[model samples]
Target: MVFEPDRLPVPAPVIMIVEPYGGSIRQQNPNLPMVFWDDAALTRGDGIFETLLIREGRICNLERHGARFKASAALLGLPEPILADWEKATHMALEAWFSHPHAGEASCTWTLSRGRASTGLASGWLVVQPISAEKIRQREQGVSVMTSSRGYTVEDYLPGIDVATGEAKGKIPKNPAPWMTVGAKTLAYAANMAALRYANANGFDDVIFTDGERVLEGATSTVVSFKGDKLRTPTPGGDILPGTTQAALFEYASAKGWRCKARELSLDHLYGADSVWLVSSVRIATRVTKLDGQKLPKPNNEKEIRALINKALG
Candidate 1:
């Protein structure tokens, strides 16, 4: 017999279905961890999702997150996701989530799976829950990292630049590989999960996937470094998922007289940089204090930086 994710009844986190595969848009009860056994989301992990932060009943960067969500769904060959439906659903969850007196920072997540396991019908829903303590800890205290090879070269991605011509050749490769789902935030995250597991097993807080010496990105975050007056991150048009937080932060930095740059970063460059950070939407900004057991320089104005990022994120 197929079972649900519960033995006792639970009541929290409102769920809304906007075009439920073959079903119409509607709201579900906020009490049970309900899921039919035939959900592809669990069976094959054929889905796309986004986790967003909601503070004091307001979603942080809802527009950007929604846009990315639609983009991800498109990458997965799923139907168009109505941004208005998501926003409407989010408001419903937010209302139920903050209805409690002890409410704090809440996380709102929406998942769009290929469809039902048996029927192949599209399925999607949104849920709101409290943020984890570890995320909060990473925000309060910085994190450590270990570099691991993601088994893909940087050039394997952005193959646009003509070596001899040295001119704009365009973005997509003339001949692309089957498994090269570089930037699509698909649900097939086994590699990402494995990388983080390896890091934790080795006493590290997170893993930054690198192509030998060429830095790529973190398992669930993006890497950025600061030196002198410039803030640098891995270049776009690569295997790296374009970081929403990184983009926003760069814009914020530029407005405040900080020069932001994007390029192919080397491990040596990152190690020698004055300050390094692992940034993401949910974790926000976590300064990298140690890499491979070697302590790195901590920013003197950490408090100021944190404040600035929080303000930017907000």
Candidate 2:
């Protein structure tokens, strides 16, 4: 299930400009110029964004995304977003998106940025577009992945720790380094894009980032592995962004008698698991068919797993 770059989604997108404060949500031409040239979103990539799935006619996991959006804004010292305004803007974009001649599975993004350097205001927008057929293909056929180094260890997240004593005298602080921006979904995605390009260049569909030993996460998704009846993922509050889709999966799977755990994981954990998957809001779940060019063991209950994933997403 190798996917080519051209197989990516090409649906016409609809955009809506939103006011960070209490202002009107107006529809805008996505192809036309909207933001100013000096906006931090364009010049310095200083902003936060979240992409969510649109199933049927409504947005999926809106509250979770809203919480994350606010958290990211706080991390960047930006003003808190009004989720109601964003909701209205998303509905506007969705209305425009469904008006298209051919509409498929759709998704929307909430983009909030620090406005122009002069005014010192904030700019926000909502974009709704159809999800790619390639994503559907990957969901059904699985994906091949390669691992990349994140260049920092999880220990780095613990600030003020004495390396000599291998411990901290007080309560161990987690992700204390604000500049690292570990959990925030900011707009500075050059490195993530570069990792994806590198993976595609190397003949893989996606990339999983590791801290040389512990598995951090997928480039754009969360990594989940199942062994027996236990489902496990890497612990968040470190360098990994907590996944909304994965959280939904855990909630539903737990009720179905599946044990879910978040702990430090390694590549060996994935390799030794009965099955591995990459989960996200748009893609739902994509199984790992191959890891670093080696074929992985297939899950015995693949059909059941897919059914569970669909139910969880719903």
Candidate 3:
């Protein structure tokens, strides 16, 4: 089918914001009411969101995602969300999306904003119907990646200096103001989209970001890989948002007898790894075929890693 960004339905999801005083639910979209968010998230990027993959109408690894979302919100000083209510909202959103005729196999996003201007915490939801099954299919063939140099990394967590913008690739000009939500999955994603556009312009599928000279993550996914029996990823110690998929993979790798470590990684380590994969809810595990202009040797253990992920998801 032709890829139409607007027609895509929201994947099954919901969001809520809970503060010390009270909480509110944001389920008002007719098609995917539970997936709606307020303008604060859109305009000011003052919110956090979770993108989840629904298989057979079931949210995968939801608890992990929720916990991480809460952590990110706390980092940004947003009100903590009610996890139980959010989970119910997610189910409601998913049911609405799946019931729609146009809804195909797809992914969905759940966003929580701080209230409105008067309150300081507001949340919203959006469910994009599925489009471009081909795009999902292409992930299996691996992807080409480009790198960006515009972002920063925080090696150690200090008060008030938590925000880090890792890279910007395309039309979205770098913001002169320091955005507080850079490390959170806030709605201000123009920077991430710009990186994606940069990758597309360069004939690649995505962009991996770096802080200074250390590898961070992709515009939309977390980077991980196996180097001879060792599985490694960039530690969340820096500005990188800790990813749910990355956490799950670590568990799976450990159960499968692989040594897992989280540390700082440089571009040199990424280019020389036996296999480099990007992890997220929808894409799951997509191998990186090339970086910059260098083609990497296909990992001899691709099948094993895939199996590990499949088992974890199950």
Model number with the top TM-score: 2
For all predicted structures, in order, the TM-scores are: 0.86, 0.89, 0.78
Note the Cα lDDT for every prediction shown: 0.76, 0.84, 0.69
Question: Which candidate should be chosen as best, given lDDT against the real structure?
Answer: 2
Candidate 1: pairs in clash: 21-122, 38-117, 115-121
lDDT by residue (1-314, candidate 1, tens digit) is 67743333333566777674333556687665666788888888888888887875688877767777876776567887877777887887777766776666778888888877677678888877776778888877888889888854544333322211233224556666534444556788888998888899989999888877878889999899988768899875455777778878888888998889888899899889988999887888899989988999987877777776778777
Residues 97-180 of candidate 3: C-alpha lDDT, one tens digit per residue:
767655555666766676456545454454534634655765688888888874644433343233322333123335534343
Residue 20 in candidate 2 has what lDDT? 95
Off by over 4 Å in 2: 1-11, 153-180
lDDT of 2 by residue, 1-314 (tens): 89675555455888898999877888887779998999999999999999999988778878888888987787677889988889888887887787775665688989999989999999998888877778989998999999989655544344323321233334546545645545678898898898998899889999999887779899899999989889999977556778888888889999999999988999999999999999999988999999999899998998888888778877
Assess the local accuracy of residue 293 in candidate 3 as a C-alpha lDDT between 0 and 100: 70
TM-score for model 3? Answer: 0.78
Worst 10 residues of 1 by lDDT: 160-169
